[model samples]
Target: MIYSGTYTAIKADVPEFFMRKFIKLERIRANRESIQKKLNKKWLTCGIFTCVAAIAMIGSYRYISGIVKVSSNVNGKELPIYCVQTDEKKVALSFDAAWGNDDTQRILDILKEHNVHVTFFMTGGWVESYPDDVKAIYEAGHDLGNHSQNHKNMSQLSDEEKTQELMSVHEKVKELTGVKMQLFRPPYGDYDNAVVLNARENGYYPIQWDVDSLDWKDYGTDSILNTVLNHKALGNGSIILCHNGAKYTADALDALLDGLKEKGYQVVPISQLIYKENYHMDVTGRQIPDAK
Candidate 1:
């Protein structure tokens, strides 16, 4: 009987020992499962971080590529570059129409005939006087820029007056052609610090010609053509200034275009030539090219 009691006691101890072992095993499995879940969460977080970092890097690269700074000299003043640069052989044909609308159709015809594009800077008075000509200019796929209201010297005017001159022309042009003027060439190529600031405030780019035909001086066609031909070699990103009122200018237009073509220069608008920064004109009147 003593022996039978000892055997029962040993059997009870065996069952208790097994239950304790089973509990320990379960605890280990629970701990392992928790560790695995934590590892997965950490990996997911790393992936998300990597994706975000990649996107940020791509955005920064694009932002950097889209902007470029240029510096060039203008009339012996150092100016920052505010325009983009293109490798394309292009030249912008800009006409200052300060007086007379009779030759408007002729100008348009010449452009259309050559399938060439040009920019016309029209004064407010001229636009009001010749609405039909303005319409034809717009319809012909030509760009319209501002040349002030009354063809006054912008440099001589105060800041407020400059603003008025620009805004008045802007509004008038918009009303007449349903197009906004993005560029302004000061009347008589005259401008100052106030003019530049006022133009910037009003969101207009002040454009000046790199080459002057001097046709307004009644230079004969050959003389005007020679001036352009001589300065034409001045390189890319040149703005050639000519007037519509000059008979010689009209006569030289076709020849000048032909010469520009022969030289393999593509004529584009001034808006396409400048960068986005506020540039100060250099002593030589060229916008400095901004370092990328």
Candidate 2:
């Protein structure tokens, strides 16, 4: 038999009996909601922190990898970035052929007449423009260096872009000359750590000059010669920088060679100048082989 109670009693009993169950159910639901909320908050916080952390890491990597500038000098000078070697009296006469290949034959003729070998940094476009000139440079027993495909600043490019620029020229030169280029000089002497690593990865040594002829400025022959002769430090090994397209450079070439010869300095290709197995990057961004 069902036991009935007074309305007040039923009300009281209803709550008494079900209150604990209801309370327990409500507690469970509230606990679930609280846990869910907590989890949501935790997840949100974690996601935000993760994103912030990722951004910070990316920025730090870019800064350290030289992908972006972390600090600027007070004078706001764009930092020069090439590893330079200055220990040796040996100077490398490296010519950059970008604008005109027409005069390449004349330059080659002059070099041939001197019986002196010079390193030629040829752009892919230049190679394309003058296949015979590229051939002549290789066939003449001079060292060939990859000068990038488009003559763009390789340091400013992404790793992939840098690889493409380097590899394209390397492959093209190899195809044309049947010799893989083992040296690299960035166009305009612009390079950074990325360039250095990219060059190293590609089995090429980075080459930079200790003395610049400043022939690109169309400096007079006397000025160019004086710049090379006066500013050039004679030692066991050194790499001299000059452009092939400059008239003054072409004019200064014979004089510079003669002066170097007079100083008892042997002008040699960069490979022979350093003559070491390992290369190191200097503070000035110049790369030199570790002295054996």
Could you give candidate 2's per-residue lDDT for residues 1-292 as a string of tens digits?
A: 1123233454565766675566567568878999999999999999999999999999998666452222211133332323245554566677887777556777778788888898888889988888888898888989898888999988789999999998998888889889888888888888766777777788877677777878889869998888877873534555677778787777677777888888877777766665345444444444445444
Candidate 2: where are CA atoms >4 Å away? 1-88, 232-234, 279-292
182, model 2: CA deviation in Å?
1.0
lDDT of candidate 2 vs native?
Answer: 0.73
* Steric overlap count per candidate: 42, 12
Local distance difference test, per candidate? 0.75, 0.73
Residues 1-292 of candidate 1 have per-residue lDDT tens digits of 3234544555665786775575567678878999999999999999999999999999998675443222233444423222334466766778898897666788778888889888899999989988888889899988899999988988788888888888898898899889989888888777666677678679877777777888889869899878987874446767788888787777788888888888888776666666557433445456554444
Q: What is the alpha-carbon lDDT of model 1 when measured against the actual structure?
A: 0.75
On TM-score, the leading prediction is 1
Q: After superposition, how far is residue 188 of candidate 1 from its true place, in Å?
A: 1.4
